[model samples]
Target chain A: MQMDLVFVGWNHRVASLDLREKLSFTPERAREAMEGLFREKILTEGAVVSTCNRAEIYGLTDLDDSFEALASYFSRFHDVDGSVLRESALSGRGDVTVRHLFRVASGLDSMVLGEAQILGQIRDAHRRATEAGTARTVTHRLFQAALECGKKVRTRTALGTRPTSVPGIALSLVGRIFEEVADCRVLLLGAGETVELTARLLADDGVTRMSFCNRTQEKAAALAAEFGGTVVPWEERIPAFAAADVVLTATGATDPVIPGPEAKRALSKARRRGPLLVLDMAVPRDVDPAVEDVADVYRYDLDAFGELARANAAERQAEVPLAEAIVEESVEKFAAWLASLSMTEVVKQLRFKLEAIRRDELARSEPRLARLDPADREMVERLTEALLNKILHNPTVGLKHGDASQRLELAAAVRTLFKLDGEGRE
Target chain B: MASPSSPGLTNALLGVLALAAYALASVFYTAYLRHPRLKAGRLATGLAVLGAALNFSFLYARSLALKNVPYADLLGSMALFGFFLAGMNLVLEVRHHDRSLGPFLMPVSLLFLLLAFVLPAGGEKRPNLKGAIFAFHVTLNMLSYAAFAVAAALSGLYLVLGKKLKHRSKNVLAGPTARLPSLGYLERAARTSLGVGVVTLAAGLSMGFAWGYHVWRVDHPFWLLDAKIWGAGLTLLFYFVVLVRAHRGAAPVTTARLCIAGFVLVLLSYTAVNLFFSRIHSFT
Candidate 1:
């Protein structure tokens, strides 16, 4: 049987943002559509990977018309013009499709190169397909290997270590300064978007003891309520700052909010054991630059963070070749696994054929051997079994390790030499 | 019972096998340094474990051939040192779930094995020092040396990473840097190794004194003034000072420097005194 693996999709690179949004599917809808294709026999095995930036259907099919059928069904289900859908999306088959899935799972095909979220997205897609009863041996192996490739790319290369966004830069900085973020108390000094975003990142990094301060108390309160935290008043900022493990400043103030002397005096009063990590994200510089002179205080302004992001991005970009090599290696491995499936089938038949011959010869020769002692007859039986095993060992090993055409030719020869049918039965 | 070859031949074969295994592990570890993968780490650990096992076998076979514990010889002791280093690193890798130190550690292990190749397989034809106390002293002393070796390697790593962080070097947090455990973890490992080293060395030295008092009589305890004894004493005291500094919350860099200096002292005690100076303990 020929298993044609295919992927049909549009991603952020190929499609407009509006088109990608229009083509996206809810998890439930994606699963339902995948099950529908499996039910219709257009896809023998299928999974739908849908996100805000991309929507893809990966499936195994035996029919030549599978891709066209999948494309038509996609357009009809979403009520899009067939020509427009074709123009916006691309479909690939065979190894090309397999390579694409590997790259996608490895984050090489993400909107941001080496973004981590796509791995989870692909895993969820596999889980959904498994639940929908639309995944089988080929697609399951492909998806599992893709996930493994994704993890290998992430851990083996430096692809995912670089921060691609501002919030990511902040977290990377925090990771550099502190070994563990769970015990850190965060002091957010503004209620603007950057502060809110950084707070969310910090919370994700396990920063629980968080308090926000703003010129407008209501904004601070609103932001604090969103993060399940309390608000700190402007007057109480010094005490909060001193108590905080990390202080993030992103305010619209034109002047320095936390002066050098004030920070030093607050730090001296607090008498903290660990270093204080300060991120000054404000454009006009909310934290005074001279605060860096204080003991046990590491400060980074916007320019420093920008520099970190740029350097890390360059590092990550340089790792793309390594990640791609991993992807290519995974694709070849998957192909080998697929080929081995056919080899397994061939070997099974060959074993059946050889066993039949052994049984026939044993039936014919047992009576003469039976005249000896029962133990002697049993010895003869063992002798012939060993002989068969030795005879079949080399060819079976060869077939299992052989390429497709070699396997086919050797399988045909084995059948013909034994006068067995293609099924390896007499 | 028939044997394929002499016990000496068998021991030499096992040594060659162990060297090959350790070299293979070193290659894998070095590869893992550039490409941090669980597979490479697992393979390196497996090979290191294999090498340690073969190394132990070689030591046992050599002891059987010589009709004594192998510690009397420089070659045997160095082989034991390599085994202990790999074995300790395997334990640390399992305990801390960290593999970044392997690339840095395997070379030291390989160096010891290479030394084993050149040193005479048997020590000088001295009578076997009686008493289990003698055995305990040598074993514990060798074990302490292994612990200090690990401490020194981790301290060196601490310094390199500290330098990178101090200067904010480009790509400091990428590639091999990403593979390294936090400086906190390295420091903890170094401190733990130092603690173990100090305790073992103290017990070992005490056992040595007791063994000497029994063997040579209390009136003839001139080995106490020997270069090896002084070297071992100062090495123990040096690591003890590092332990105290660590307890007092000395900076990681300072503790690292102290551990390094302690290892240097250990090197002097293990090598220089044995080769260059005459002493009652010059059995190797």
Candidate 2:
């Protein structure tokens, strides 16, 4: 039976982040687990990819019946029920496996549509597999080509430049409004990781005055101290609206914290001074949308940022054809290298067949050439050599033109034609 | 003298047919507004599309007969406006998969088509650089108006949906009517239309100013005081402010309301020239 490359797992499209996290293996754990699989003789070769978004197992197996065992092993390793794992796991064989890996590495299968993070995650997976000593020639070559294709796609296209996340889009709008962030005073309404990331990004943009206002002032103070910013009391948030040039509200409030009337009054005060940029980043917005009716007060919510993000994503999507072309070029190169792996067996069989014909002919001619001189016998040897060369020439030519399927057929034909099976009759 | 093979017959017939169809469709839409039944709403949408298709066929036939651009005069412009409104409603219905907007859009289209029937036709074709640029300019303006009409309709729907979602806390409308794309979608549509409108308006204004300069050779451009130009300019400034605020991520619902306001200005600009003043674009 022919060896086949297979990929089995779940990713962001089918499973959520919480489910993926439950299934994920740490890098060290993945190595130990893969090594254990090899020690158990369950897989000849295997690799584990565990990212925040997905956990995939790619393997090359000589035995076709080993899939059930591998699936069972995966279920056991993740402590997930066999039925649940089977439902979430995607398995691709042969060419489909190659295509799936390439698509994944190209970020075509990502949750955020065209995010660039998956390529790095794939690279990390490859590194872990190599260190685990489970990555064979086929898996190594395939992953290397996949990584190169990802790099080419990113550099040749605008896919990476577009913002897909809410915070990223808000920052893009901020860049449009402010010439420089140096004098900008940003007020963050929540102190979660998303808010911290937004604050850090704003700080990197040279934002000087960054204040964190959370329900708990101590938690706010801790985050504020870490980012070299101050903490504002939640009670004073309404009155502090004037000091905030860019107000970002992403609190866990069910009701709007900044109501329409208060925002209108604040806007009237701010207009006497300057414009105030408000970003209501919460799911259930923290600020009333009616606040925008007040002149010089600009406000945005999650859905608004999503539109801008989609538009930016659309602009980047224009470069998809270029990225696809790069991936196609890499697929061809990988296919050619994979096809060349059978050449050694073909060469050995050819040599053996030629020598067998030589020996047989010499035996048949021994009686006829017994009366000939030593010099004449030497001429007969040269004639035999030429005959063998001419006979092997067409087979050699056919072997070089053959692809993987044809190569496999040719290898089988050579072994049968020469009777070079386990019996070893040259 | 007008050419014997001119588009007189086709334009008159299409004008009458479009007006009649729009009037019928408007009644159906109004019925939908009163009853708000699913079946009635579907029937109204169907009638609206049928009216739009007739208007579309009329435009095509007129364009073929005129051997020039179809929407060239006030009658043609009004017919085109009806077509625009109907087409906009058709798209909204399909996209939102709801026919709640049929009531508002059908009457507006019917009014335009009815006005088209009464507007004077057969005005002498003015030949000049301004008249040449006028067709392209007005076509773009009408296209922008069509987009704004859809934006304005969606804005009104957003207000109703926003109120329903807020007060009733019912997610039933959220799937169809309230699922009217995020306020951002409507705002972007408005901003884009306004952007295109501003450019076309600028082009039309510049062409008029140039033509006036050639004819009168005065330091004071006559188009500067033209009511149509001034109205369009004011509308342009209103949208510019909307776009600027929208760029800062202004609340989508409020921006949608602002877009409705912008569309009102557009309507006023279109009518103020035809009803109140004689300008470069005045067909009569």
Candidate 3:
């Protein structure tokens, strides 16, 4: 018999964000649902991994229809329509389930690709399942193997070394040029959404000196107050450019806000510390294209960001096969362990049969031995028990140590020799 | 006067091996610039270090075979300049942890080494009036030119990258400019080399003039009239102006251009003055 694992899930790749949101579960709800699974005997062991990008259930079960049961359970638990859930849900079993879990844990299956956050989510799901008493022997081992795989993939590869997002790539480029981002002054030319997002990422990178300028004083003030930065008046923005090491412009102006001559004149007064990096994220381009002509000014538009992000993403994607190979290796090891489990059952049954025969022989010979001394009877019993143990030892060792094919052959031989082939309880 | 001699077979063989090592390092460095692989960068630096060591041995062997130091003639002086440039790059790599400069600087030393073989090795014998001072002056002068060579390379990189940014080329953010150290960093590297060149050239020139005055007190004014003397002095004055301008907040582009001009003067002072106009110095 095979130790089958079933997996059912929806992820960003196959399902829309709306669908994932509808299918996602809170930690408390996921734990409660796992406990229900064990109580109802729907699964012997299972874990529910719910993250912003995906929701999946990994279960060890003997039932052939375990995938359908898991999907139905998820739909009911989340109060989502079963038809909609089934439309987007992916199902896998056996080694497929093991490999998927490993990939997810290693962050190969993450939406961002090689992001480290998914590992924490996987660990949380495992802990919750273990606490709810739903994750037993097989799932417990599976998750442990997955966590090890995650660590191995990270330590052995450069997958997570480069940044993959637009803001991340931009900041990384700045890091390459400048010795330190913390010393660089950033000027925000607009209070738009992209500006806000870029500001947050820059602040996270330790760029504390920031100046916000916008046509709307209130909006600029609000943004500046939020980040504890200075708010420059819209009129003084060009002069503010002189003090900035980086300028991020995303204004919705029809004409250029910073022309070549204007920016060059402003930079002439700037401190001669380093080159200035300007990111023109505006669609119409707030900074004049000719502004790049100004000496020591490095300008990049949104398209440049996209190009860099694509390159970084491509590099990360190249490492996916290596991570998948690791997953495959781990799955094979899991399959071997599962095979050994069946061997354990065969060995236990064979030992029990030998012991039962020994006891029966002793019981039948009791009257004949009653005439003998107590010591002689006791010695005869011990001698029969020892003989039985000696007979079972070789077969037990072979079942445990032999390869899969050899172990199966030996199991069948034991059953035939003991006449226990039809005993189906085990 | 001792006759000038070609480098011995062993010296020539070592020179060839060193050149091969540098050529290999240059290939690795170019690949590393594209990929930024740690292994490739390390291998390039390792090969460069090995090449420099072999180059040093080759120079020592040539000097021994010639019965004089290598800085006495054009070919040996060019070889010495190559050694200085390679040593400077190695120092920069170790101190800054930046191998991005290797692809630009390595080719220069390789050119100098190649020139060492192509140029005539024989030169006039010198009178032993001030041997120690002459050796000091020649070595310092060669090192100053090496420093200028480094400055010129940095300035060239600055102008090329600056031009790419000026054109707003789509590949500016993805091409060679993307892999370079910042314009600010390159400018600083250039200014640093320029400053070194100015100081060393000044010291070397003053030492040469003082030694000349000691040798021919009455004819010292004629020494001042020599083209090599004027060329060396003008080269010194040119870099001194650049250094001062850089200190007084000259634009980085202007400073970079000035460094390039200073290196031109360096080339003229060493090559054109020695070859055509200088009556005292012998062609090598």
Residue-wise lDDT of candidate 1 within A130-169, one digit each (tens)? 8877776677888999999999999888798788777887
Which residue segments of model 1 deviate by more than 4 Å? A1-10, A18-50, A55-106, A122-163, A169-191, A205-426, B1-17, B37-40, B65-68, B73-76, B116-129, B212-230, B273-284
Model number with the top TM-score? 3
Candidate 2 per-residue C-alpha lDDT over A76-123 given as tens digits, one digit per residue, 9 for 90 to 100 = 887878887777777877666777788788877777766888998999
Compose the digit string of candidate 2's lDDT tens values, residues B1-284. Answer: 11222367765666567667767777776665554455666667777777888888887887777666666676677778889878877876787575656767788888887777765465477544235555566666676677667667767765654454333232312124322443334444455655655565566556555556665455435646767767766776787787678666675566778888888888888876656684664654
lDDT score, candidate 3, position B41:
95
lDDT per residue (tens digit) for residues B230-283 in model 3: 888888888898899888878778888888888888888888888888876544
Interface Cα RMSD for all candidates?
3.2, 11.7, 3.5
> Where is the poorest 10-residue window by lDDT in model 2 chain B?
B166-175
Score candidate 2 by DockQ: 0.02
* Candidate 3, residue A197: lDDT: 93
Please provide, for model 3 over A306-375, each residue's C-alpha lDDT reduced to its tens digit, 9 standing for 90 to 100.
Answer: 7766766776788888878887888898876655456666677677777888889888988998998989
Name the better of 2 and 3 by DockQ: 3
Task: Name every residue pair that clashes in candidate 1.
Answer: none
Q: Local distance difference test, per candidate?
A: 0.80, 0.70, 0.79
Quick one: ranking by lDDT, best first? 1, 3, 2
